[model samples]
Target: MSFALSTTVDLDFDRTVAALREALSTQGFGILTEVDLSGTLKTKLDVDVPRQLLLGACNPAYAYRALQAEERVGLLLPCSLTVRAGADGRTLVDAMDPALMVELTGTSALTEVAAEVRSALRAALDALETR
Candidate 1:
């Protein structure tokens, strides 16, 4: 609960996704994977969900630091961000809070790395607000 950094934007889903990609890039993150959650669910389970996309974002330097701190941390490798359509017709963006790594691993060594990643993610979300 309360595990993400989120914002709602005025743009529609597709536009929001595009803007988010650029925003994340500005924060030194690259998309390592993308998933169209809505589409996949509709196809796989015949269930309909609101338009949703998941982006696996990664910043190499931060990731490396995390890896050095915890050998198994790569299991959580590549941060996740989601773009989804809200009922009000606005698009919502959410990024997984990096602090979760420290919580889950119970390691102080990852604290700094998590903070750096969190800041970058916050900056990226702020960038979306300006667009």
Candidate 2:
């Protein structure tokens, strides 16, 4: 089974990023970190590249519950939301399917949390589409 879902949209990179942040907010997820790979690579290694952004997203409640189940679960605390520009000049939004993600760990406590996360993520994706 796929752990993530992705969709390509016609918006430019910057707009897409904004839409993603909005979508995340609507789903009760806060973006804990944002990484601009293109800029980082260029500034750190002098390698110019296309647009690529990584967002570390988390729902604090779910994270805390998951951690209570397993402290080491922090390894996967924040889910990744990646946005990238294709060569065709289209933007793509990708996020993990928390249902599938939790399954990988085989933790019973994560099942209920995964359902909540899946709902939030689905809302996020719908929000992106409407934007």
Number of the top TM-score candidate: 1
C-alpha-based local distance difference test score of model 1: 0.94
List the pairs of residues colliding in candidate 1. none
Task: Please list the C-alpha lDDT of all candidates, in the order they appear.
Answer: 0.94, 0.83
Identify the leading candidate in terms of lDDT. Answer: 1
RMSD each, Å: 0.9, 1.6
lDDT of 2 by residue, 25-123 (tens): 877889999999989999999998888999999989888988877677787769888899988988888888777646767777788887888788777
TM-score of each: 0.97, 0.88
Instruction: Supply candidate 2's per-residue lDDT for 9.
Output: 81
CA displacement after TM-score superposition, residue 111 of candidate 2 (Å): 1.1
